[model samples]
Target: MDEFEKIQKLIRLKKYETPGEQFVDEFVTAFRERQRAEMLKQPALSLLWESFRAWYDQLFSPRWTLAAAVVVIGFICGFAFMPRGGQTHLARRGKAPDHPAMTLSLGKDQTGKTLPAFSIETIRVMGEIEIEPDPGLLSKHFTGGYDQIVIVPHDEADTAIAVPYDFIHLDGKPDIR
Candidate 1:
């Protein structure tokens, strides 16, 4: 006989036996008992998990809490140090010059003309007029030969006058005040 056939014949003739029935029953019973114990502990484990989640939320629940605190503090500081209406703390500290008093008046002329009078300790003009367009022709309709005219107040004289009454060209230079 060949070596392979001999080995196969020996293996066939050998006895193959399973574990005893009592051992299998005991093992299964122990496994079932252990599984039951583990199942009984699941409720406690779930309770612990819920408690951990609650603790975490309590620790970090303030969304943007630091930012909110900073804004509130800033508001409090601003209100505490801000100037009141019509008055300034800087003025009280003498860091700024005192404002001068001013007076305004309106009177009528002998010819029944309304006149506006103003008096101020200090007067400043933020902007000045250069070439003023004609006020008389502002309401008139556009014509082919119509030219733009401007009225400017004379600094030396009290009355206002136009440089060119009819047709005048400005050299794009402002008149001296």
Candidate 2:
């Protein structure tokens, strides 16, 4: 016998049962029907839903959201502790009462003449000043025109004795000096 005839005879003898063609056709039909039904259904608010999900995801992430919160807290704390322009605790406590009105006259060294204007204000002395008379100007004027002014608290009256020049000296250190 030929190879093809022999193979066909062996197949017939085995009597193997194959799946019904109707089963495959039914499965394909059902799959197509389900796909058509889903395609026909309307999606409500799909665009809005997608946008909301994207925004929600970004806001919940640690990097951007946590940094924004920290910056807001820093600004609040900065404003709370910042000092106002004219209100200072150190000036209020250590300011000279009488000499609150103090002035320093700045003038030309070569000429004995005083300048037209000068500054007068409260002195807040924190340290000592060494006064050496300007020899060049002393011949023309008895007192040195420009002298360093030292400001100290009013209660440190005894400490004021260290300064030499009369024109630039405080009258007396306050008890609270």
Candidate 3:
């Protein structure tokens, strides 16, 4: 017989082959039994991990995603807004700090020229300062909201010229460039 004819005969014979009726009926029962056996042998940690993984997968599932996200967000907001010990966050922030913001103690050096003394204590929230443009519908004398940058002289304040990020020389002539 030629290759094509031999292949056709083999396929025709294969069509008759099928699993017995008993296998189909017992498949679900057999699968459940195997799963139960596997679970029984699994360690506590493994079982906990599997449960957590399954729960995490379910939380992000399409049908439950919106509800789960809302619940998570609500919990976060609740914790953030809730007072700790005896003080609310806004209440604490509003209260005036115990220490002075800035203090300058003057002392004359050996040369008797007043030694430039400056102590500045500052806490800054790192963020981009947003300056919204003024439309100037009802314009004042000054174009901007603020009048000008007032620079106190060296004698009035311990002023010195330094680099852009002025860590050393705090009080100095303003860089207008």
Candidate 4:
């Protein structure tokens, strides 16, 4: 006979014997009992520990961990390097919006208040001035703003320029300005 015919004959004769129902039931019961015993042998973790483990699992889940990490890192970097108020203009290299909305030119036609003529020496002095407070706009001026002229020497040059030091805080203190 062929191999296929021989295999069919063996199947018809029930040559492959399985365990009896009683033995199967006993084996399953023993298995369950052993499993229960093994589980009972290990002590339960504390609520705090269990919660931390759960949180850690969720935080590191493969489907979301990378995206979540990127978002968290982005937020940290943005806030850490973000410029404070009133300094954003300086950070962007733009004119400060708080002071001097319009540039006054020499020889006014309507007001007739002859704008001071700009000279080369005066312009050089103006360039040395690090900060200038608007005396007209008290609200826009720095905190503790007052009329006090103090001359400070430039670090890079031998020239001494006058500026209100309180108005030129490097740390940008809003309360002091």
List model 1 lDDT by residue over 1-177, tens digit each: 999999998988656665677988899999999989977777987878878989866876577667777899998998787533223323334333244322223344569785543322221212221122322332232222213222223456434443332211122222222
Q: Rate residue 79 of model 2 by lDDT.
A: 66
lDDT of 3 by residue, 1-177 (tens): 999999999889987787877887799799999999999999999999999999988767866878888899999998787533233334445454444433333445558776544533221212221111122310221122222212222343424432122211124323222
State how far residue 79 of model 1 sits from its true place (Å).
Answer: 38
TM-score of each: 0.21, 0.25, 0.39, 0.33
36-94: candidate 2 lDDT, tens digit per residue? 78656636576568678999787688777788889999989976775432223344455
Backbone steric clashes in candidate 1, count: 4
Q: What is the C-alpha lDDT of each candidate?
A: 0.45, 0.49, 0.48, 0.46
* Model 4 spans with C-alpha error above 4 angstroms: 1-15, 46-61, 70-177
Model 1 / residue 166 / CA error / Å: 48
Q: Candidate 3, after superposition: displacement of residue 119 in Å?
A: 7.2
- How well does candidate 4 score on lDDT at residue 60? 82
The stretch of ten residues in a row with the least summed lDDT in candidate 1 is 122-131
Winning model by TM-score = 3
Residue lDDT tens for model 4, 61-122 = 76687889899999999878853322332342444434432222234335766544221101
RMSD of each: 22.5, 18.6, 15.3, 13.3
lDDT of 2 at 94: 59
